[model samples]
Target: MTMAQARGTTDGWPDGTFRNPVLPGFHPDPSVCRVGDDYYLVCSSFEYFPGVPIFHSRDLVHWEQIGNVLDRPGQLTLPPSTASSGGVYAPTLRHHDGRFWLIVTNCADGGGNLLVTAEDPAGPWSDPVRLPGVPGIDPDLTWDDEGDCWCTYAGIEQVRIDPRTGRTIGEPRRLWSGAPGAQAPEAPHLYRVGGYWYLLIAEGGTERGHAVSVARATAPGGPYEPCPANPVLTHRGTNRPIQNTGHADLVEAADGSWWLVLLGVRPGGGTPGWHVLGRETFLAPVTWVDGWPVVGGVEPVMAAPPWPARPTPQPPARDDFDAVGLHPRWVSVRSRPAESWSTTERPGWLTLRARGASMDERDVTFLGRRQQHPSCRVRTLVDPAGGRGGLVVRLDERHHHGVEVGDGEARVLVRIGSVLATVATRAVPAGPVRLRVDVLAPAPGDWHPGKEPDVLRFGVESADGTFDVLAELDGRYLSTEVAGGFTGRVIGMYAATGSVHFDWFDYQPEDGDGDPTPRDGGAI
Candidate 1:
């Protein structure tokens, strides 16, 4: 049986459970399509490879990572700066004429949105084709029963396209402007359910004022009328803590239940509210009441997850450095200067050779995904013959936490608002010492519970010195709510400046819990 067959049925979310965005932590601008009872969804990658992450869902609740839509350079390239928040934006995933299609905007070069598709999710995808003259952000496609396809985008414009050639079929038209059009409406999607064809859009830029609005009309091309309900979704009453709730893609479950997935950011930690893993993905329950869409725990239902228990289980996010290569989830924030990071160079460890002495704040590989979960401890064995290595929580080059074993001393870098201040440091013999980090994850519904404040800490254990707390992290001051980025917290390791190599890194999710593959390769 296939991955979808593993699940029994697809429908009826636990009313309130689908709250916020469905896919959380670093996945953003989601577009999902249903083929039979199986669901396939994709998200924009900006600078990360696998430009569009494709996921599979059966019940619309449980989701699995099927593969990436753009798997090769021929399809997409690793960007230097997709935009502080750009790169690949608003991707529309669809199935047309028996083939899979995904079109997106590559912002690194300010290139136009391009299209790529494959016979299967894990693809040898086709080369990207630049769209014909449509500009701005967020592009989506709608297919009618006649097999006619219409492309809707951020512009006040719509274009008909040839399903077979992936080219324009007719003159593009500037259709309807939503909510007086002043909302700077973007990320528009067109779909037909009943007698009414619905046009859903995101307006008010990507910040606290963001909203999901809708309109309806009799034809694909409109003189569309705004839904009677007006702004279907808003973050009005909620403070800036949950600010900026826009960019949405809606879907109908196999059981005819309606759901919408959008991109949202939670700013609560670090300076400027970090986007450690980048833009987070959210899903909200939506319903049509008198031809309008209502969002966020609409009456009988609760708010959606930044989309939730999709069709698949979260894949194994943990990895043992003992493996030959870095895990698939690992990404360098900026372009990697060198690929000398080879496991063969240092046996029994995934070694990352340090490069440029200082890196740009927005992009750095060391500033990896925020491990997502809270209360996790990561420890690594460093065979520092003469250089440096350590474990860290990286948001970018500027904001990061790590206990480094270098310069004959172990020091913890406390990142505070674009500055790295050595919070704690100690002298040790230092050659081949082990550095361990324990990051405290925030508990649900407990933002400021002091007894259990979401803080981070690090320690250095060595033959020369016993394990000692290098720094006691105070996280009450920061959160996704404060360090504003589009994603959740992820943690990893780093090597800086020169080519220093790292040894075994053991990530223990939930502090003190034994790591399944704790470093066995004793430190030199």
Candidate 2:
């Protein structure tokens, strides 16, 4: 039987059990916090606009994207140099003194590290407060029992700081560097558990060698001792299906149990070392063993977690473009999207004013949502209006595949490195056109390392109720491994040169099945 036949269903999601990637797609470097009975999580947005996607969940298994923290241009900016994996880095979310605080590093700007606060995580967050004293990525904020505020950062250092003004009271003191020989010690999180101040950090470069280590001191700042059993959690060098596991946050449930939320990548079928979905949020139970927290191993699907079961809210599978504003899930690149894209100008349609910058530059006229599944279909209706516009499966500026309807013709464009070539083009009977992209799942044992195996099919719907194939491109070119970024594929609408209006966008994904194969090595 075929892989699809063996699964017996296309829905993919398991019943009565949750999967490893609680939050799928490009969601990475998860930072979670619990306020009362509710849990809130945030992830690194990189160059994507409406930066720092925040999610809410009653049960860890199911999550809903509530909002984007940096939705305003004044709040965040992405310069031209802010490459694919360069913008907002690991963000730490914390609740203290009746307010929600988010700290992150914007590598694209000279600001370095910054802080933002909100009364409600789901809305209008305050402008960023530049933390000049904190000079590193993945910054975390903590408070001692005496209300003394401290900033712990990836340098494995700590500094007493004024949270409101982002002023440092003293020089930053270097702390433990993690396990003796571990490399790239980062993602530092401090917790005052019981009688000791526990410091958790991830090392091994956030790749296959990534790992989580722990150390503790009697106080928040001091000479700390490494956990006897260092690297409390890691999947490095193991064939556990989930790799690059690290950058985690710990949360305490109301039931007094501890749970860990982190990031991990799932390789495609047949390709044991290649993954395209990027780093995703994963959950695993924490059991205190000998005064040290031991994070249990995660499986592809968790049959039954230790926590009490609860109902999870379902998210809509498609966007009809009927709303007055952009949905929270829809995002742009480098800068705020509202300045260029609109949903109110045209009722039940999204109007994109074409910007001068092509996909090769910053601030391109593109708005898209993350591609969450390996096998999925994305379709959009567009009216080019004598301009260049259509649907695009974008990995970044230099790597993408799109179907364009403009200049009296419809064409398929693929850009790999410095090569921009048209795979196919055809003169069409001018009218509103429907552009569609279908990403077929890779077959098991078919993947070749350093090459693309997933097939991305491009086509346009005809007036006679038929679809014409424009081109078939290899999907592996967009994979994170080959693309050299910390993001996944994002499929959405695009326009160039003039104005284009999109009637609607529909996205659907097939259930996960098959052993999967890597892509075949080939030149684009």
Q: Residue 381 in candidate 1 has what lDDT? A: 67
C-alpha TM-score for every candidate: 0.80, 0.92
In model 2, which regions exceed 4 Å deviation? 1-15, 269-272, 306-309, 337-339, 444-453, 463-466, 514-524
Per-residue lDDT of 1-524 in model 2, one digit per residue for the tens? 22232222224333546656778889999999999878899999998998999999776767788999988878898876677888899999999999999999998877589999999999789998988988888999999999998999987889998989999998999998987777899999999999998999999988899888999989999689999887888898788888899999999987888999999988764454567778998999899977899988777766545555554455566777787777789888786555578787778888888874466666688889998877887788788887888898888888888998887788998988788898899887566788888777765555555435467878897657366777878666777777788888888888786888888888877655431323343333
Predictions in order: lDDT:
0.63, 0.82
Best TM-score goes to which candidate?
2
lDDT tens digits, residue span 1-524, model 1: 21122222244334434433345557777888888778788876666554677778765656667666666556665565554444667789887767788888877665777877777765666888777566667888888777787888886578887644667877889877777745678889898978778888888866657888888888889878887776787775564444466777888776777887777665544333433334566666776676677775422124433443343555553455667755445655535444736677667666666654433344343524436433566666666566565677654434456777777888877675666677788987746677776555444443332332346667787656455776767554234444554434456656664455665556545532122223222111
Cand. 1 TM to true fold: 0.80
Displacement of residue 31 (Cα, Å) in model 2 is 0.3
